[model samples]
Target: MTRNKGADSVQSEASAVNAPRMTDKDFERFSEFIKREFGIKMPPSKKTMLEARLQKRLRALCMNNHAEYCKFLFSPKGLESEITHLIDVVTTNTTDFFREPKHFEMLLSSVLPDLHKRTNRPIKVWSAGCSSGEEPYTLAMVLSEFADKNSAFDFSILATDISREILQRAVNAIYSEDKVEIVPMALKKKYLLKSKDRKKRLVRIAPELRKRVDFRQLNFMEPFPFRDKKDVIFCRNVVIYFDRPTQNRLFNEFCLRLVPGGFLFIGHSESVSGMNLPLRQVAPTVYQRI
Candidate 1:
């Protein structure tokens, strides 16, 4: 008995196609690159997860394996465009309207009320790491409601994220009906427009609310460029991926950007623990700049 030559050739090709060939060194280099460039910490335990996420990019670029992809990524030309794709692939954009409702409740109940009473000047809110416009739009809806009653109170939102792709989506201001389900009926009616293509199940945010939010591409690793300090900064669920040192640096930056006694809202799972930052916990997951 003997093996057929054609069959042997096919088997060899299949094995090469399906093989997991990302070396430990390759993983280490990519991990370091992510941490240094994006402030995201990818430990050894996340190697499998990182490989899985990057596999799609490898296929899209017609690369055979992670090693080739890594080389391409660091190449001069790849650094310009491929790095954007890499960040888009590596970062998570999981968000919904009114996510972590308690924060919004606190904003309306305590933060906004106190700020309104403090001064008659315009209010500034920064929605850092605002993915897909949901958070900022939600903020706008809440602020709009307050303005409707007060008449004289004015506010504006700055929504920023590192991923250009996500920022574009946010500017489009289109969302699925399911994405807006958490929005209260009155607010949804006021702020959302039912798309003409009802079959597509899409909703576009009203121009009034959309215009209040200024969406921009921003990397948190860089210095924030704003002349005016914010009355509130919403950086929720964005820094959970960073290590403690990175978190500390980010919190300090937030403090510097915020007005004295301004508010900072983070994810429920995140904290300012172990860091003697200039922020005091005013509510669960809510901090005020000192």
Candidate 2:
């Protein structure tokens, strides 16, 4: 067999072209930019993951290297769209219905009952960093069930995420069948509608339940625009991306937005310990504004 030296050379060049050659300086620059803008800490250990994720954006723009992509990202021409694309690529959106089930249990067994007894006003709940609509819809289902029995009770849910793509999905209020598997059977039956097209294998949140949630795109680094305080804030699993200082500042902000005695529910793996915030721990990963 004759050796195809030309083909071998071409293949070698192609592999080299595809491989990421991001420099340490370039990685540091990106790490610093993301931390400053989004408060997401990306240390040297995440260099490979960051490169892998950002490669998609580079390919989409037909950029050749990390330096060129970084230059474009900082240029006037790439300010708006490129920045949003970078954020979407870097931000984590892992969420599901009834995630961290104990928090929901606490809300049902303890928090809502106390709020109902204390106030006749409409309840306001904020599902901060509510990715792809799961958390807020879960809140709505639970609150809806509560409201059905307590005829005078009324409530609204505000769902926010930094990713516009995720916010749109939240607004659409559609989900895969598997995504709703964690929802209690009774609540699922009451609140979810199977899509008419069975092949889609999708479910839609009931119209009434969907109407109760308002989805918005927001970055926690910026100032919040809430005029009225929230009775409950579900920011679970969102702050894991941020560092301690960022988490402290964000928890304080959550405290300010919460009504006195308002509930704050974080993820199972998270805590408010040693933060010196105004919240008192009421249950595992559950806190109340003091």
Candidate 3:
């Protein structure tokens, strides 16, 4: 006998509403797996946080309990398809336009000029963990403006993130008005397009600006796939999630991909001090590959 469609719908809705909370045992398993796979530390303090993030996944998978979700998440099928989504849910993707304005100031005054002298080739920049495209788009605008005043100054940007969903949003290049408020009016007017309908307080990056940036998915734990080395890498606020050993390993890997004297800008709150790497501090939280 076939089940009634209406009853099935009700049952599913009820199951979601009353889904079981993640148990401590399950959280422990998840924390260990996440740290081993992604290099993200998940301490006991974050058990509630993990539980909350994983709930949406359970709902999406139509699973009513942690047991059901965990079983699928570990299965071969789920590893192939659902793992990306799980990674997306777990990672925090906070970003803003022109965050840490001093970095841009240093870029324009010091880094750009140094690179321009070397060759007329477009300066290559990589924005690791670029969330929703704000940081890279900001970089594009900054670089474009700099190119206008300087002769033979051009650049390309590569924005990468571990989260597939956020990368897609970054590709869309759409943002609410408030999201771009911190952006200077001059740059916004030049690089962003207003929505055709005035009723919607949304904007999109200008086509030229959007095209200048290439968005890709990258996991710090995985081997980086790049044929050419980058001139500068902006990996701000991302390493804070990893443990000390992981951070050191990732930074060393970045150094391997950077041209000698290539600049690295990290979040002001993070430091690369005490780690043995082929880098020297040039400015606050900024280093040059040696």
Q: Using TM-score, rank the candidates from best to worst.
A: 2, 1, 3
lDDT of each: 0.90, 0.89, 0.90
Angstrom error at residue 224, model 2 = 1.1
TM-score of 1: 0.92
lDDT string, candidate 3, 15-77, tens digits: 657757888888888889889888899999998788778888877888887778888888999
lDDT of 1 by residue, 111-157 (tens): 89899999789899999999899999999999999888886899999
lDDT of 2 by residue, 15-38 (tens): 657777789999999999899888
Structural similarity to truth (TM-score) of each candidate: 0.92, 0.92, 0.92
